[model samples]
Target chain A: MTGASPADTAVQGTVAQPEWQQLDRRSIWVAPVQPLAGLLLAGLVAITFRGWDRFGVIEPAIGAAVAIGVFALSAWHWRTTRYRITPTHVEMTSGMLVRKHRSVARDRLRSVDLTSDVVHRLAGLSVVAIGTGRQGGESDDELKLDSVTTEEAERLRRLLLDRGSRAPAVAVADPGGPAEPAPLARFEASWVKLAPLSIMGLVALAVLAGGAAQLARSVGGDEIWRSGPVRGAWDWVVATPILTVVIGGLVGLLVLNAVLSTVLYVLFYGGYTLVRADDGTLRISYGLLTQRSVSIEERRIRGVRMDEPLMLQLGRGARLRVVAAGLGTKDGEGKEKKDSDMLLPTAPAAVAHRVTADVLGTPTSPVGAPMRRHPVAALRILLLQGVSLALVPAAVLLMLALVGLVPHWIWQVLLLLVVPAVVGAWLEYRNLGHARVGEFLVAQGGPAGRHTVAVRTDGIIAWQFRRTVFQRRPRVLTAIAAVAAGKGTQTIKYALQDDVLPVARDCVPGLLDPFLEPDHP
Target chain B: MRLRPPNNPVHPRATTWWRLQDAGFYLVVLVVAAGALFWVSTAWLVGVVAVIVVVGAVDIVVTPPIRYRKHRWEVTDQAVYVRTGFFVEDWRVAPLSRVQTVDTKRGPLQQWLGLSTVTITTASTAGELKIKGLERGFAAELVEQLTAATEATPGDAT
Candidate 1:
C-alpha cells in the first residue's frame, strides 16, 4: 500500500502527472458499517412490526447475503476510485461499468471541504470534496475523494488552497509549521446558553410534532387516546382550569425545546473554530458526531452576513455566514452542504461582530455600522401589506361561519391576529435600511430573522431596481445588488427611490452611470 | 434620479408572434374551462368565461403593442440594459466585464418569423438579461459581440 503500487497503472506512462492514489484501505471495512447498520435497523423494524415469529430463516439468509454483497461492492468501489492533484487540475476517475472521469482546474477551485462521519472518524479517515466556481452545475461539478487519511486530508486542504505558495504534489509542509494560524473564534461551553435562542429547537419540535401526528394517524389515533395513561391525562386536563393547563403545557414545551436545542447545537457545533490558515484560506471546522471542515479562499469571499433571528436577537446572539462564491455545493447524498457557509453558529452578538471584522480584515464590521432608514411611507406600505395578508384568513373563516360550517367565534378570534401582524410589519419597517461605509455596501431587512449583509462594492457584478405596482405610488423600490457570491443577490428592500439611487451609483460607480439621469438639472 | 428608456424596441413582427402566443394560451384556457363546465352547472362560470374572452381579446389585440413598447433593450460598450413587462416592469443591467455567456434562443413562432431572443448572463443568478424579438441575424451578431467583449475582460468576472 505504501509503494508506487500497480494501481498507479493509469499514470504509469505519464511523465509529469502525479501518481493516482486509491481510497484508504480501512474504508473498505469502515464505510460498509454505515450501510450495514441501516440494513440491520431495517430488519429490526420489519421484525418488530411483522412479529418475530413471521421472520423465517430464509429472510436472515437473504439479509446476510445482501450484507456481504454490500461489503464487496464497497471494497470494489475503493478499488476503482482513484484521484490525483496535478499542478493545473485535481482529477478523479471512478465507477466500473459507466466509467466517469471528473477534473476541476486548480485555479477554479473555490472550496475544499473535509467531512468525516462517525464511522469514518472511528477509522481515522476523511472525505474531501473540492468545489469549483462553476455556476449551476450539479453534483458532478465537485471532485470527491471518499476516504483518505486525516493527515492526507489536511495536506490536500493546505496544498489546494495554497495556490499562491505553489507547493504542489507531496512537497506539502507539516501541520506543525512555526507560524500556526490564530483562530478567529472557537466554541465556548458558555455559548450553549445561546443555543435555545436559535429557532433550531422550535424547528426540531415542529418536525417531531409532525412525525408524531403522522405516526398516530398510521397506528390509529383513537387507540392512543383510548390508552390508559393518555386517557387519565386527558381527564385531568379536562378537570383542570383552562389557564393552568395552558400554562403547564407551555412550560413543558419550552423546557423540551430548550433541552432539544442545546443537545442539537452541541452535536452540530461542538468543537467549532473559525481560523484564517497560513495558506490564505479561512477554515471552519465543527460537528461532534460527523466532524466537518470547510476551507475557503479568503480572496474569494465577497462579504459577511450576520443573521439575527427575533428570538436570537432578543437573547443577544447571532449567526454569521461568509458570503463567498464556491462555498455552495451538494454532498454525495445530494444534501446541500447546509453549514458550508456558516462562519459562526449562534453565539454572543459581540463575538459575532468581532469574528466578522476579523474575517473581513476590517477594524469595524460594516454590518454593525449605522444605516440610512427607509422613508415613513415604507412603513405604511408594509402595514397595509401585512393587514391585508392577515385579513385573508379572517375572511376565509368569516365565509365559513356565514355558511354555518364554522362557529362565528373562530373568525372573531382570528381578527385579533391583526395585532401581531401590525407588530411584525413595524419590525420589518424598522429593519429596512441600507448604507455605504468605506468600500462596503450594507443592507439589512426581514421581520422575524434580520440579516445585515456587508458586501464589498467591488464584488457587485450588476444592479437591479424593481418597483411593484403598489410601491409606484409611494415612489419606493427594492434595490438588488447582484453579486457572484453568497445568495447571489443582496437586497435593500423598500427604500425611497431618491435614497437608493445614489447608494447604487456610489457602490458600482460607472456601472450605473449610463442609466442614471442627473438630479442636478 | 430617473432612468432614460432603453434605445431599441423589439422587431415589429414580435407583435404578431405575441398575438399568436396569446391565442394559443387562451385557446387552451377556453378548452379547459369548457370541459370543466360539463361536470358543473355554475352560471358564474359563464360570466368568468365572458371575462376571460374579453381579457384574452384585449391581450391579443392591445397587449402586443404595449409589450413591444415596454420591452426595450440596448447594448452599450460598457453594459447591456433591458426593460421588460407592462404592469410589473423590470429593468436589468449587466456590465460587459462581468458578462459570463451570451446565448440566442428561438421558439417555433420566433423561428417562423426569423426572430430570436438574446440572453446575456453574468455570474450572478439574478444577472441574466434577455432581449426578446430581434432579427435572427442581428441576434447572432449581438451574441458574437458580447462573447468578444466578455473574453477581452481580465478577471474571473466574479
Candidate 2:
C-alpha cells in the first residue's frame, strides 16, 4: 500500500484560525500549589511548635500574605506562557525571566500523546507531548506543551500529521485525501477487573487484625503498645498469635489476591479498544477506575515481548509489553519510569503476535528456542541458597557457644535449612531454557516463575560475551544483550562447548545488523 | 555506502598506561579488603567486603583489552570498525548513518593529559561504542566529521 505524501495531504480548503483565548486562570495554580503545599506544611509545624500565643496576631496575617504572594507570582508566570498550533508547526513560548521558545515542525512530527491527571481534568486541560523522531544535531527534540485546551490539542495533532505527510519523499501519493485509519479493536471489561477489590479487601483485613490485637493488649495490661519490649511469658503468648494470625492471614490472602487481581485486570482490560488512525498511529483506550488513552506511531515501537505467567500459559493468556523509547513518564524522583512503555497489559498469544506484526512491522517468526542453564548451574544456585539459609542457624549456634550457652541439640537447625534447599534446587532445575527461532533469540529461567525475553536481532543494540576464570574452567559463558531503553542489561548465563563461540558470533552479527545498520533493514 | 579507514585508532602508547592504572586499582582494592577483614568481626560485613573486593579485582583483571587491533571509519559512507579483546576477541561494526548522536567527553585527568573520549549513540540501543584516550583535537574532529556524514545522508521518511 502506498502511503499518502505530506504535500498531497496539505489542506486545500480555506484554513480557519480560532480566536486566541486564554486558558482558565485557575490552571496556573497547579505549578505553585506543589511548592506551596510543602511551605504551608512547614509553616504549620513551626506555628504549632511556637504556639499561637507566641506568634500573636501578626504571624497569622503575615502567613496569609506570604501564601497569597506566592500564589499570585505563580499565576502570573503561568498566564504569560502561551502555546499555539498553526497549519505549519506547533509553537510554545514560556518563562518570565529567560524566555524559552520551542517550535515543532508539523512535517517532522511522529505522534502527539496527551495525558490529563485529576487536576488537569478538573481544569479541562491536558498535557500534550509531541514526539519527533531523532533530529540531526539536536539533543532535546521532544516538545511538551502542558496545560492546553482539548480542542486545540486535537487541532495540533491533525495539523502535525497532515503536514508530516507532505514532506519530500521518494514516492508521493494522494496526500490531500484523508489517511485511512486502521480498524479499531473492540474489547469488553471482564470479571478479572475485581482483582483490585480483592487486594483492597486483604489490606482491610490486615488493618483490622492489627487493630484488634492492639485493643486486646490495651485491655489486658497497663503497658502502652509503644512501651519497650514485652518481658512476661503471658505477653509473648498474646503477641505470638497476633503475629501468627496476621502472617497466616496474609498467606491465605494470596489466592484471594490473585483472584481479585485477575478480576481487576479483566475489568479494566475487559473492554479494551485499540484503534489505528489513517496516519498509521495506534490509539489505545482502556481501564475501569481511571480510563487512559495512549497514541503511538507504528514506527515508534522498538520491539514487542510476549510474556506468559505460569497460570496464564495454562489458560491461554499472555502479557504483551512493548519496548518503545521516548514514551515514558517521570517518577517522583524525576527519573523516567518504564511501566508507561507497556502497550498491552494482557491478551491471547495469537492476538499479541498479530498486534506486534501490524504495529511494529515485525516478520512473523516462531518463538525462539527456550534458553536453559546447564544442570550444574541449577545445582550451583541451589547450593548457594542452601548455604545462605544454613548460615543463619550456624550463626545462632555460634553466638550461643560464644556466650557459653551452647545447646546439645544443634543438629535440629541443620535439618531446618536442608529441606528447603533441596526443594528450591528442584524448582530452579525446572525453570531454565534458551532457544533461537529464526531471527529472534528467546531466553527463559528463574525459580517458580519463568521470564521469557524475546528480541529480534535487529533490535539489539549491543551484545557482549563474558566469561570468568572460574566460568571458563567450567566452559560456561554469559551473553549480555543491551536494548535501546536505558534499562541496564540482560545477561544469559549458559554453558556451551568451546567450539560454539564461532557459531554464536556469526549468528549474532547477522541478526543484529538490521538494528545496528543505519540504512539496511 | 563507502567505507573508509578509522580516523581514531587506539594509540599503542595508551595501552601501557591503561594496564598500569588497572593494576593499581586492583592493588588498592586488595589492600582495603585485607584491612577490613582484620578490623571487622561481624561475619556479614566481612563476607560482603570480601565478595566486593574479589569480584572487583577479578572483573578488572579479566576484562578484555581496550586496544582495537583493526579499526576503520568511513565519514562519507557513515560506518565504523572496531576489533578488540585479547583471548575472546570481538569486532563491532557500526554505521554513523544509523547513529543518533556523537558525544565527546574528557575527564579531569584526561584533559590534563591531552586526551578525550567519544561515544556514538544509536537509536536501537543505549550501549554505544566508546573510544577513549584520543587526542582532544582528534575527538572534536571525529564529532564534526560524523555529524557532517549523518546530515549528508537522506532522512528516512518512515
Best by TM-score: 1
lDDT (Cα, tens digit) per residue for candidate 2, span A34-122: 56675666566455444456667776687688889987877776777776555566566777778978776655565566665556666
Docking class of 2: incorrect
Error of 2 at A521 (Å): 32
Off by over 4 Å in 1: A1-14, A35-66, A137-140, A168-172, A206-243, A397-410, A519-521, B38-42
Span of 10 residues, lowest total lDDT, candidate 1 chain A: A1-10
lDDT of candidates 1 onward, in order: 0.85, 0.55
TM-score of chain B of 1: 0.93
Chain A, model 2: TM = 0.64
- Candidate 2's residue-wise lDDT over B112-148, tens digit each? 6677777876654434566766678877998898878
